[model samples]
Target: MSPIELNKRQDTILQIVKENGPITGEQIAERLNLTRATLRPDLAILTMAGFLDARPRVGYFYSGKKTMTTASESMMNLKVGDFQSLPVVVAENMTVYDAIVQLFLEDVGTLFVVDEKSHLQGVLSRKDLLRTSIGTQELTKIPVHIIMSRMPNIVYCKKSDSLIGAAKKLIDRQVDSLPVVNETENGLEIVGRLTKTSVTKAFISLAETHDL
Candidate 1:
């Protein structure tokens, strides 16, 4: 399961409650310099999501429950394969110049490389190609496999992996994309691609599902 994500204001309210427990609604509002009417929605949401509790004649206190229904809850439950797009790939033996052309023609920042048997071999990014094409370097002579990130060094995802896990990996590794692959006895077989666009699409779909 993924963490229950909160908006900026919600986070602030949570911090305030943690630091000053049993805080009254009016006091909480004063700390944030917001009117009680404006902060009501957040308070109600926090209470409903089990993040806060209210007592008669008292104030609001932290519930100590971590789970909540977030705007991205639908997205977090989705599988990586559900949002993966058709992968763009090039032969490992393809020239760097040709790889550049494909990268542009396909309008993608990264490309997966494959062996003659169509097994996953490596990954090539725009930066990788650009780095090799600089100065007097001969891009036409250099094979993609020479500069591509080889297997075992590549970060990938399985179809069954959760979407939130994928997002975390993307942020943690600082990579633009991840290959959706299948593990075979021989090696991983690239099936699809998961990029920032994929995550955006998932979010849009989730929002639509909620009629929001």
Candidate 2:
């Protein structure tokens, strides 16, 4: 027969065991306001599923092997809204030279381009500025809109997307940053950004959780 899946209560029991492991069944029942008679079935099933181990006198302990996959699953389910970084925006009319200064000052690889109305126009990366500065010093006179990437072709994401989805865009496109946008009455508004660094920080957090 196939193994039984853990129900919500069982999941909780497993968590309690992990946190307060080597704890007795009586203590687990007391913490949840449940009687040993009522909690025995769940405790038995978790132990049977290899999620918990019970000693003759030492109560319950968590099996250390299974939490790796659980932590990975939790990382994949994280939403973009909570992790996005503040946008570094420049007006479309700004000069490329000025935009270059802002780019360096902000120390970001990509900058979000916006019109006076605060609507997204395009994106600018260090490459864009470097290409503009190669032979032409007219960067001071040229408007950013002249060299900036335009919209519709921009690969972007909404605030509600998963971090894994945003990570894919960064990887597949070989780009360093993506503008997090939201559709509005006039046009798409730049809300936040997802960067390669953001993904790194997330991975670090997952690693820390796994170590715990």
Each prediction's whole-model lDDT (CA): 0.80, 0.78
By lDDT, who's the top model here?
A: 1
- What candidate 2 gets wrong by more than 4 Å, as runs, is 1-69
TM-scores, all models, native as reference? 0.64, 0.67
lDDT per residue as tens, model 2, 1-212: 22334556776887898999999999999999997756754564455345677798988998863533354465666666656778899998899999999999998889999988898998998898899999597989998888887866588888789888999999898788899999888998999988988788767554543342
- Worst 10-residue lDDT window, candidate 2: 65-74
TM-score of 2: 0.67
Clashing pairs in 1: none
Residue lDDT tens for model 1, 1-212: 23455667877998899889899989999999997756765675566456788786788888886656655554555677667777999998899999999999999989999998888899998788888888437888888998999867788998789877998888887888899999999888999888888888666545443342
